[model samples]
Target: MKQNIYHQFITKKSSGKKSFAVLIDPDKVNAKSIAELVKLSIEAKVDYFFVGGSLVISHHLDECIQQIKAACSIPIILFPGSPSQVSKYADALLYLSLISGRNPELLIGQHVISAPFVKKSGLEIMPTGYMVIDGGAPTTVSYISNASPIPADKSEIAMCTAMAGEMLGMKLIYMDAGSGARRPITEHMIEKVAQHIDVPLIIGGGIVDPEKAYLNCKAGADIIVVGNAIEKDFSLISEISAAIHSVANVNAG
Candidate 1:
């Protein structure tokens, strides 16, 4: 029902808090997951469900979104990796730019092509600056995206990129280590970036358990997103959500 998701979310139009959003890539999720995932996500109080992948080989995206939206009340946001991944069923989109890459296509050319369609669909666009960090293994996103990730140890490089993204008007900075990551972005990197940027920071990839997700939150990541872990074991969803949500509780007086 909301027309402007960024204004609403970043401006505290909903509440004065930024929330944790869960990423659900349809390509990685199995046939049996749609119904149960929606139920589990709701039960975990996840703030959103992100649907989309770099390559959607099937035209089942809309159906997937429909099924999940029908099963849950959480906002369905599209984390599209390509033009074909866009859909109207999702409430919003993280119109992402691979800022860490030098590829013009992913950096802006794709956005130019997809802009009109996204505008026509009336889905809220949440402009994002996406940075890929080396996760200790060659992951699907890294291999398919065809871009070199910023070295995991280079917090300075990450910081400058995030600052540049903010200056360029991106509302969110998502630092990912790539799916099937052998490692996740470091807490020190998270703290460095969080300290330098004003936008909501989103961290994902290699977060296969609650403690890892919570540690990222402890380092000031506003939202911790995990997808592959859930696809591998749905029962881990409740555990992860509890661990992540408890970060706030531990700090409360």
Candidate 2:
């Protein structure tokens, strides 16, 4: 099997270069908007483009991915909410299992249903342990998954959850605060989880500014994902990317 671009990207994280990704929810943003976002992301030197949402009530996923691919050369990775969100147009899929929640479906039921189609699609399958941490708001992912978000201050629980995911052979561990969060995951929480886990750490949700992004990276996040903030202010793409890149440069130096 050919190594996917995302897999290769993760492999390089050990070199201490932090990465930045822009997340696009296909349901909320139209194809034209996605094209524009991709253009901006490319100009900002973003490392990846994440496509998906918690509840995809719309049917424009393929359209969204196609538009992004048409406008940019960056890797398009699927951050799917459910089985229905799969599309062949993406370069990779974050085959996520909600390890933090007790929901059976999110842990395995959804994967069982989506596996065949995913396998056929030939997209790089990056099995990820997806954990939702309390972000000071009720987000769609927690509602849709029918699972409770881990308490914001539970670093030990988060660490153990991530460790379990790694032991289960997950390629990545994603700690999310869900969209529209009032607070991003704390640097202490990220530090605790990253210290216990061996895989790349992806931190997302409610990161409203470059300073927050910088803190997450400094706390040991391998890839910092920004979405809602970018939606509100596209200029944040450049600022956040620069912040992450600045950290990477300093780390390398």
Candidate 3:
């Protein structure tokens, strides 16, 4: 229901204040179960909810979003893997272009197909340049997207890719190590990209603990996203949320 969602996020994070977000991949949870999790996530002080996945198996994307929206005050953002994963029911959509991959479908072709629907749906669209790094494992996204990830160890290549994306007018730069990644994106990579780009930096995938989240924050990540970890333990949202906010508050004070 909220408009100007991208600006809202930017404004919300001002003054070094951090927020907690939970990524809901519809492929992982059903409507009934997701509602239950939303309630628990709210109790965890999670700042927002992100819904989408590499492959959408759920028949109830809009319905699930509406159900969760009714249960929590947290804003829901769409993190679509393909154009079809989009639903107009959420607050905003992260319009991601996989800069790490040479595949034109993810880069622009898919966006072209989904653009009209997105605009007509009245959802806020935040243009983002998404770069997937080769985590320790071969992720479903990498497999389905059929694109190679930038080497996790190559900071210069990552920086150049991110810079090119920004030059092309992306609002945010997201670096994903892919879901269930054996390792999270390194602090060094985050620091390298953060130093180079002015836009918000979103880092997700394989972040399983608060310490790792703290490391991303320390490396200058503006927003951090976690999904699979919370799926394994609903309580993790609270634990990691508390850790990130505590660190943010400490730094601010």
Candidate 4:
């Protein structure tokens, strides 16, 4: 099993190093595309690969992970949208709890069902508090999870929710605007949530450009995850990665 992943996240946070992760939806990519992505990711020095999607309808999950594993050493973390998404091929799993929603199923029900398999799979578990923020347009996650997102303008609600999740022993806090979001989670919201939580914060969804990725890191996102945009244009991998890493350089200097 891949070890010390949570430690890596904490150590990077303590050192003010920002990470860029490319999110790959199994339903979206194939063996050839995975090979291409892995090659670009290696060139980009991308920090991690987040695998999974809100609604994966294909059997490409294991094949995708195997192809990447065969190609490079970049860590593959499962960002599963359901219990069925768990795979032994990945290095770790984001054991997410939808803390932002009122849906009991997503908050804990899914965890209960996936726990035994996850524990047996030997995947390092990262207990993440998942918060969905309104992104100006409806997303598959919101619709499928049957939960309304926290309003984008409500930073206080986001901050408090993160604090509560941290207090409840969550190792990380992930703020997402959902796939293909019309607007990314705001800098203000990221700052507020970062200030309130000691755990590493991951911001994703609707982050399509290098500038937004860079600004998000500056706003205290320990990790920036990009997906949909990259699916359309794989070249963004290097550009966005450089932008995120530049934050680390600035902090180090």
**Higher-TM-score candidate of 1 and 3:** 3
Worst 10 residues of 1 by lDDT: 11-20
Model 3: weakest 10-residue lDDT segment is 1-10
Worst 10 residues of 2 by lDDT: 1-10
Mark the regions of model 4 whose C-alpha exceeds 4 Å error after superposition.
Answer: 1-3
Q: How close to the true structure is residue 17 of candidate 1, measured as C-alpha lDDT?
A: 42
Can you write out model 3's per-residue Cα lDDT over 1-253, one digit (the tens) per residue? 3347677667755667666678988878877779778888878788778898888886678888988978877889999878887787898889889988988998999888888887787788889999999898999889988999998899999999999999999988989998899988999999999889878888999999999998888787878899999899887888898887776777877
* Backbone clash count for every predicted candidate, in the order shown: 0, 0, 0, 0
All models: lDDT? Answer: 0.83, 0.90, 0.85, 0.94
Poorly placed runs, candidate 1 (over 4 Å): 1-4, 11-18
Error of 3 at 46 (Å): 0.8
Tell me the lDDT of candidate 2.
Answer: 0.90
Report the lDDT tens digits of candidate 4 across residue range 61-121. Answer: 8988988999999999999999989899999999999999999999999889878888999
My TM-score estimates for the predictions, one after another, are 0.93, 0.97, 0.95, 0.98
Residue 137 C-alpha lDDT in model 1: 91
Q: Quote the positional error of residue 21 for candidate 3 in Å.
A: 1.6
